[model samples]
Target chain A: MITKNRKITFILSLISAIIGIMFAIQLKSNMNPVPNESRSIAELRSSLQKELEKHKGLLADISKYNLLFYQYESSLNEGDSVSVMKEELARAKRMAGMVGLEGEGTVVRIQDAVIPEPPPLSDLEEHSYIPNAVIDEDLRWLSNILFANGAKAISINGHRIIATTAIRNVGEDIQIDTKTIRPPYEIKALGDPDVLISGLKLEGAEENLKLAGKQLIIEKHDKLLIPAYTDARVIRFMKPVKTKGES
Target chain B: MANRKFYLYLTLVTISTGFLIAASIESTKARNTERQNEKQFQQETQLNERILAEKKENHQLEVQLLELQRKVSQVEEALAQRQSEAAEILSELEAARMMAGVVPVSGPGVIVTMQDSEQAAASADVTKYIVHEQDVRLMVNELRAAGAEAISINGQRLVSNSEIRCVGPTIIVNGVKSAAPFVITAIGDPATMVGGLHLPGGVMNMLQDYVKIDIQEKEHVEIPAYVGDGKMDSSAS
Candidate 1:
């Protein structure tokens, strides 16, 4: 009996030690930081792929600028700098959203969804819940999706989106660049219509709008014109960074 | 009696051990669900490192591109000094470039930093506590309305075509992925921008519940020039 009792105690102690070791390991792992816990492997790969493509684009841009610099230097020596400067200025104006653009692209229109009238006194709580109509965020997302799909220029209700342009919501109205726009928002984009349509489809733009009690209508146009930015505020706060040999 | 006592002690020891084992297993299981297998973890780490390295290289290229652009501009400036026609166009070009965000600018402005709230990770509704692209967009819009002349987010210059959006857990600005806390630098009147942001029922009031935002007024804020070609694929008439 004495021997059996000793054996049992020995086994129990062994089991306890093993459990203690496991508990220590569990505590250590819990303390370690897992930064990528929320992201999956597929997501990581896609992000990395995007970064790679951006890197390639950056490389091409660097080379293009280098060539431009050489061209400008030689033109200066040839005494034909005025024409070159004029052409460069024109290009700059286009990039600054100061000139209108035309191309084959897509136009998307969003309008409020029609809701049927509910029975009187069915449920007071249900009647009190009002669906949100088209808001500024929806427009912002639509434009972003359009841009991501290679849209060169985008305008909503004739308000061209520029670097400084902001689409916002003020009380009951939506404003683009501080100008209030009414319902039936028409968004015109300059790009390949097929690509833009696919981009929107991939994002389930129509379904998302439907969920928010809005209807999305997409149309393809062979020739679409997007207006230039109209609100050109005087740039009073910023001055260009001075380089060497400049006044 | 001695034997009975020994049995009682053994039973107690066994019961406690069982509880300890159960607790440890439960904790470990929770962690396992959060993390994938060893191979996946390794791949993720490698991918992250590679992406970071590529970003660094891109930064270097951007700097080089900026230098080339400045040289071209200097040549134009020199030529402008010699001729009156060239001088008129040169000034217009400079202003256009600044408006296009192709050139870097500096002035007195405000720097706004936004981060996810401390309780975001612990909250069940993480979306409510985390920052979204719309929040950043609203902030930028408010700044622009307050007369901000230049703006950049996380060192990525905002051009006419720049899009601020989210993919999964990352915020993609100007085609580059970044995570919070986002630092937005805007060149404008410091006081006016602050006032605009602080207005009742403004962006600050809306986002105060979800995000932690800090705005600092500085005398000098340098916004970098955009580094892309800025060329429209379609025809510009």
Candidate 2:
């Protein structure tokens, strides 16, 4: 009888221990569940959607180019290739920023902030003052913001921004395409004025400029003219990549 | 009496064990139903596979489009050879397209690769060490100042209106989002571009502390054409 009792006790203890371990595991897993996989799955779904849209766009581009090629071939057959070529050249020139363009857009003016008069000599030590000045980086950031907001064409002062245009500081002066520009810098961009204005505001352009001791003044214009890139562009390094059939 | 007590203890322990098992089963079932099940895992895998397939197809279509564009160019060249007037116009158009970044270009230039500093992942102040949109813009400006004729970042060709800006942690170039490391290829004098980047207080010097940058001069660098919308509808000249 004693031996039987001992066997039962041992079996019960083992069963109880297993239950305790299982209960601990269940409690632990419930408390600290695995990282949410659903969130990542949602991300994957959105990315997939973006890729599908891009695929559609690429398909559209291919069709458009195919149509253009067909037109060229037809023009060749009709002996009207010159006119068609001229039209194509004109379009290329316009897209190359080789000609002036005018359209409805927005005008942004950046000016140096006016400093108030100093209170007194004794109060100067406690007052930390930042100078009000417009820098090259400010213009670069503003132009980038404008372009991202769908600005088709942009010009600062009178210098038109092109593919190779560089805005940088040459010593103390801000140069746009090798021309020194001064404040208050007047920036004209051709696009939807409301959208451009909202872009600037959304980027907190005013607040940023204010922190730098400059003022941002934006105006919507019904007609804004952006000049052509005047700097002489010499292409020396780049050559067109030859196609497989071309010699 | 002892036997009776033993039976009572055994009954209590068995009941508790049964209760623990039931609770565990209940929690496990709840979790499985709440978060992820086998079906959800399978669905996620399927979605991932679809995305990968779509990306592959898009790449193939882009190549096909490039070929078609080249055919057009070949035809134009053949026509230009037949007529002198057309020849002049064709040459001008070629130059304009090159300047507008509408045509693929190949030449000797420098490629600059930039990435977030490795220490940034461990550092508390991560923003200072990571690459930003301003850093990229500054790099491009420097390259252009050094006379980079053609430039592209991660295959996105730079055009007159190309915008490089930061949206969250990714950099958007020509309306497409990409993350570091950004590889900027410039077709120009490699030595001059390298010098420009290394100038004291230049973009490289300023950003060197925050990011990892490597500049390589290569004899051949091929830049693709701008695939974005080339038409300027707002510009009515």
What is the C-alpha local distance difference test score of candidate 2? Answer: 0.83
Query: Model 1 over residues B69-188: C-alpha lDDT tens digits?
Result: 778878888888888878888888888989888778889999999888999999999999888888888898899878888899987888888888876656778777787788999999
TM-score of each prediction:
0.77, 0.85
Q: Runs in model 2 with CA error above 4 Å? A: A1-19, A22-42, A76-79, A114-126, A244-247, B1-31, B34-50, B230-237
Model 2: per-residue Cα lDDT over B1-237, one tens digit each:
987788668756875776577677767886777665667778888998999999999888878878887888888889888888888888888888898877789999999998899989899999989888889999999999999999999878999888998777677887777777899999999999999999999988899988999999999999987764534733655
DockQ of each: 0.38, 0.46
How large is the C-alpha RMSD of every model relative to the true structure?
A: 6.6, 4.7
Candidates' C-alpha lDDT: 0.81, 0.83
Q: State the lDDT at A32 in candidate 1.
A: 66
Give the per-residue lDDT of model 2 (tens digit) for A1-247: 9899888887876776567656656676677666664546787887898787777767766886687678788884525877777877777777788888888999999877666885687776676557656778889999999999999889999889998999998888899878998777999998989999999999999999988878888999998889988766878899988765221
| Runs in model 1 lying further than 4 Å from the true structure | A1-51, A76-79, A112-133, A170-172, A202-204, A211-213, A243-247, B1-56, B121-124, B230-237
Leading candidate by lDDT: 2
